[model samples]
Every structure is written in structure tokens, then in C-alpha cells.
Target: MDLLKFITAGSVDDGKSTLIGRLLYDTDSILDDQLEAIQRANRKNDDGTLDLAILTDGLKAEREQGITIDVAYKYFHTEKRKFIIADTPGHIQYTRNMVTGASNADLAIILIDARKGVVEQTRRHSFLVSLLAIPNILVCINKMDMVDYDKAVFDKIQADYERLTKNMNSTQVDYIPVSALKGDNIAMRSPNTPWYDGKPLLEFLETVEVNQQPEVQQARFPVQWVIRPQTAELPDYRGYAGRVVGGSFAVGDRIVALPSGVASTITRIELASESLTTAESGASVIIHLADDIDISRGDMLVKAGEQPVLSQSFESDICWMDTRPLDVNQTYLLQQHGKTTKVKIQDIVYRIDIETLERTASDGFGLNDIGRIQFKCADPLAFDRYAFNKANGGAILIDTRNNLTVAALMISEPVDH
Candidate 1:
């Protein structure tokens, strides 16, 4: 079965964790030992039902304070498809954790409390989801039990959400009413909402179409490791091993090593011990080149005719993840997959106010801040705009002092300057 990676996001106490727990419990994905442990905890809701939130609120701080502090990942599968659920923190202070968890999500389930309707955190997360360019979005109107499963409440909230996201950059937006605490409209449609006509959350997830790769099919292989084991058994073996992050590659296809601008043909492709005639995206294979051109780690291989922008300067949308305010003077380590380079922040064009979605001049970014930033790299690098190619356009900035990731970057385009 193919895997579906998704995340749950909303304000505090919006039932993000409980919704995940209900999905797992209803799908019979939880292990026997885990169920036993939950029983031992004896956590239950006011309705005397077992508190399913404990399944995802794993941290001690979370259990004691009754709020999620970090991103919690849960795995489960049904006969139709597998799932990786990221139960991200809903508190405003933990917004960075939510960004980290939602980075790789194929779909985002933004939960709304039936009682509270749409709020600031809801707008904040919707903006982030749009900014991240997640393929699909599902707005789960949760906690229907608290509101007596009223159709009007669901309708009002759905209308508000539609207005909120009317100008947002999203490809697909869907809605479903659910009561995670009572397991209604989660695994299957509930009779409680006789007026509502829609598939349950699990069924929708099983059937949703997810674009697995970017639209562009230009092959990109960033060399992660150069294999040159001079052992007698394989004396002449010189292979470049890495995961194909984009497009496809086949034996005899002409390729070019970027930055160096040297060209060669693919002589062979092997995954582990098996020989392959062609390698597609997400495949980790060893590639043999027809000619040696001093290719090394941090260098990228692409089709000879097609080229990604090679430049030292670029514009990007940056989500500042660190508590320390950004210092434009200090240089950082820009890590793009296997490649790393020294980079400095050149300018802050504007900061995005999550509350109003307005752009304002900013001195620098702080924790949970989203802004447009211009940066210059010490060396020219090969990459595509994030909108065009996700595999090549995403990167992270690391503080050289502590090696802490301070920012997540989404490249817009290479700056001519």
C-alpha cells in the first residue's frame, strides 16, 4: 500500500491529538502493549470513554500540563493505504514545532473547534500551509459532540474557513465534520449528522490523490557519497552513490556535473546488489559515469541539456525557527540535502503578519516569524525555484556556533545581483 503523510494543526485544545488517536484506535493500528499501557494510565474523558489523546501526547510535559509541547509522530495502516500522522503542537509558542512537522506533509488537516469557530491560530496555520505549498488541505470541524453535532455550527465554521482561505494559495481544500472524542464521522459516517453528506476522514484519506513528485521531470542527483573502495575484488569500481531527488536516470543518458560544468554519460546504475537499467525519483542507487570528472559530494548531476539556476544569490521565503533574532552580519551554513555552503543574509524584504497576512518592513526575523529574505552564498549552487521543483529548492540554515537549525528556506528564484 502507498503511504500518506499528513499533519494535524490548530489552536490549543482543538482536538488535534485526540483526532489522531481516534483514527488509530478505530483503524486497529495501535499495538496490544500500547493499548495495555493506555489502560494502565486510566485516562478517560468526562463521558467515561477512554482518553485516546494519550496515544499521541507521549511526552511527560504534555501529559502533566495537558498540552502538546513538541511534534509527535504516529504511524498506522489500513488494508488500503499506510499513514504517517504528525500531531503537531497547537500552542502559539510552539508554532516552530508545527512548521518542522508540516514540512514534508502531503496533506494538512487543520482542525477547528465547533464551539470556538475560526480564530487567529486557524489563520496562522492556514497561511503556513499555503506558504509550504502542501498539495491538499482538509479542514476537520472537530469536537462535534460538545456542540451536539449541530449542522448549523458545521456550516458556519465551513463558511468562515472558506472566507479565510479565499485568497490563500492552495490547490485543494476539503471539509469534514467529526467528533474525535466520540468517534463520529472519523472512521465511518455517523448517523448523528444525517444532514451531512460526505465520506469519513479515513475513507477520504484512502482515496485522496497526492502528487508524489514535482511537475518538472528534470533529473537531479546530488552526490551524497563518492564510493572508491580499492579492494582487490572490485579494484576498478568508482561509483557515485546518492538518492535521486528528482526526475529519472537511465544507463547511457548524458549527464552533467554542476558547478564544475563537466559532462559524462551514465555507464551503469545499481541499487544495493541488483543492477538497474533506469532509476527514478526517490531511488537510492549507485551510478557509474562513463568518464571521471573529479565529481564529489555536494556536486549535483543533471541531464546535460537542462540546467538548474547556478548562482550565489537568491530570493527565498524564510521561516525563522530559532529563538535568537536573526543577525544579518553573522554567516550561516546553508544545507540543501547533501550539499552545504556558507551563506549570509543580504536583506529582509518584508515580514508577514500572520494575523492580518500583511507585509511590513522588518529589521530581522525572530521565533515563528515568516518573511521574504535575500541571501548570498559563498559559492554558486545549482537549484530550481521551490514552486517549480521542491527537491532542489528546499534548504535549511544552520548556526555555525551550535550547529542548530535556525531557519527553513524556500527558494523563490536566483537573484540576478
Candidate 2:
């Protein structure tokens, strides 16, 4: 079974957790001990109801506050596929946490309360998901039970959301109506809303095609470590080890080490208990070179014909994470993959208005603000556009003094020459 990773996002009290808990419970994914524990807790509660939300609200503070403060991950499986769900917080204050959770997700399931109908938080998260370039989006209009499962209500919400998404860059969008509490149209077809004849949420998830092509326009492999075994068993063994950020590498392929620009041919590819001829994106393997080259941690290996832009200056879209305002001329450490370097903000072009989708001319950015900015690194860095390659295009800025992550960046454009 293939593994599928997805994220859940919506406004507070939209039953995001309940939907997930229902999906797991109804599918028989929960263990017997877990069900028994939940039953005991349900009996002790004053409401005397199951409170299925308790299955995911495992934290003491979460139960007391009745809101998810952090990203909660849940794992379950069906006969057809394996699932990894990231239950991200919906409150505005936890926007940074949401970004962290959705960074690696293949799809995003955005929920909206049928009665509420496209609230501010919904727009905020939708914009973020688009900015992150998440390929697939499933907009689930939840809590249909409260609205009498009205078809008109679902259509209105869908129309409003469609108008909003028209300006965004998301490639795929799907709409579904569900009542998470009663398990209507979640794991099974709902008789309550016979007007809707689409596949259930579980079926949609199992059948969604998530195969993505490797970003091969620019080959990149940031060296994590230099593997060396100097014992008598196999002396003079030197290998460059790292995960492929973009493209593939095969034995005997010509490669160029960046910053030094030394040429070499791939002599071997090594993995645990196996030797492979080729390696693709997301695979960690040690590569042996035909020539003795000076390469170390923080250096990158790329195909000689497809070299990435190496620049000291670049522009990026940044999601500010720190409470303190961003300042021009201030220095921070930019970390990408295994490479880290000191960088300074050259300027802030503009801040994006999530609701209006407009760029407001702003000199500074506050927490949770998304803006376009220019950066100057201490040295030239290899990179590709975020749309082309997520691993090579993403970066994090850290405050030097406090060592706190202040910004999450996506490379928008690279400076030529």
C-alpha cells in the first residue's frame, strides 16, 4: 500500500478533529485498548457523550481549552492505502505551527462550517496553502448536520470559495459536504443528503493519485557528511553522503561540485545492505566519485549540464514567524538543507493582504505576515525556484543571538550574474 500524507485545516470549532477521529474509528483503525480508554473517559465526562474529539486532543491543555494549540499527527491504515494525517491548529496565533505541519503534506483538507460560510481564518489558511504550493486541495464543507444538510447552503459556500480561489495558484480543488459528528458522508455514503452522489471522503483519499515527478531541471545534492572507512578491510574509501534534493544520479554520470566546480564521474552508489545504480529525489545514499575531489559538508553536487543559479542576492516570499518586526540591514543565519550562511535583509517589497490578495507597500513585517523581500547572503548559495523544487527552494532564517527561527522563505526569483 502506498503512503499518503495530508493535512487538515479550518477555523476553530469546525470539527476538524472530530472528522479525523471519525475516519479512524469508523474504519476500524483504532485499537481495542484505545476504544476502551475513550469509553471510560466519555462515561466520566459531565456531558456523558463520546466526545470523539478526545481521541486527538491528547494534551491536558487542549482538553481544558478545547482548542488545538499544536500540530497533532495521527496514523491509520486501510486495506488499500496507508495514511498519515497532520491535524494543524486553526487559531490565528498558531499560524507558524500550521506552516510547519503542512510543509511536507501532499494534500490539504480544508474544512469550512456550513453555517459560518467562509470565515476569515478560512481565507487565511487557503492563501497559505497556495503559497506553499501544495498540489491538491480538498475543501470540505463540514457541520452540514446543523444546517439541515441543505444543498443550497453547500452550493453557496462552494461558489464563494471558488471565487476566492480563482486568484490563487493552486492547481486542483474539490468540494465535499460532510457531518463529522454523525459520520455522514465521511467514511460512508450519507442517506441524510441523498442529493449528493459523490464518493465518500475515505474513498477519495484512497484513490487520489499523488505520484509527483522529480524536480530535475537543476540537479542538487547537499553533502551532509563525508563517509570514510580507513581500516585494513577496505582502505582508501571516501564517499559523499546526502539526500538528493532534486533530479536523479546514476553510476558513471558526470557531476560538478559547486563552489569549487570540480568535475567528476559517479563511480558507485551505496545504500544500507545494497548498492544501487541510480538514486532519485528523497533518497539518502552515499556517492563515490571517480576522481579525488575536495568536497565537504555544505557543498553541493549537481549534473554538469544542469547547474543551478549561484548567487549572493535573491528575492523570496517570506512568512514571518517572530513577534519582533523585521528590519532592513539586520543579519540572520539562513539555513537550507545542510547549508547555513549569514544573510541580511536588503528590503521588503510588499506585504500580502490575505483577504484581498493585494500587495501592500510595507517597510516592515509583523508576525504571521507574508511578504516579498530581498536577501543578501554572506556567500553565493545554490538554489532553484520554489515551484520547481521544494527542497532546494525552501529556507529558514534564524536569529543569531537567540537562535530562534524568525522567517520561513520560498525562493521566488534568483539574480542572474
lDDT of each: 0.88, 0.86
The 10 consecutive residues of candidate 2 with the worst lDDT sum are 42-51
| Reference-based lDDT, residue 184, model 2 | 87
* TM-score to true structure, per model: 0.94, 0.93
Best by lDDT: 1
Off by over 4 Å in 1: 60-70, 212-215
Highest TM-score scorer: 1
Clashes of each: 0, 0
Tens digit per residue, CA lDDT, model 1, 87-121: 77777767777777888899999999999999988
RMSD of 1: 2.2
User: For residues 1-417, what per-residue lDDT tens digits would candidate 2 score against the true structure?
Assistant: 899999999988899878988889878988899889988775332335466777876653664676535578889999999999988777776787778888888899999999999987888888889888888889999999899999999999999999989878855889889998878898889999999989899999998878553445566889999988898986999999999987789998999998788999999999994789999888999999999989978889999988887889999989998888786757899998888999988878899887787889988888889879999899888888887788888999998878999889999897554
Question: How many backbone collisions does model 2 have?
Answer: 0
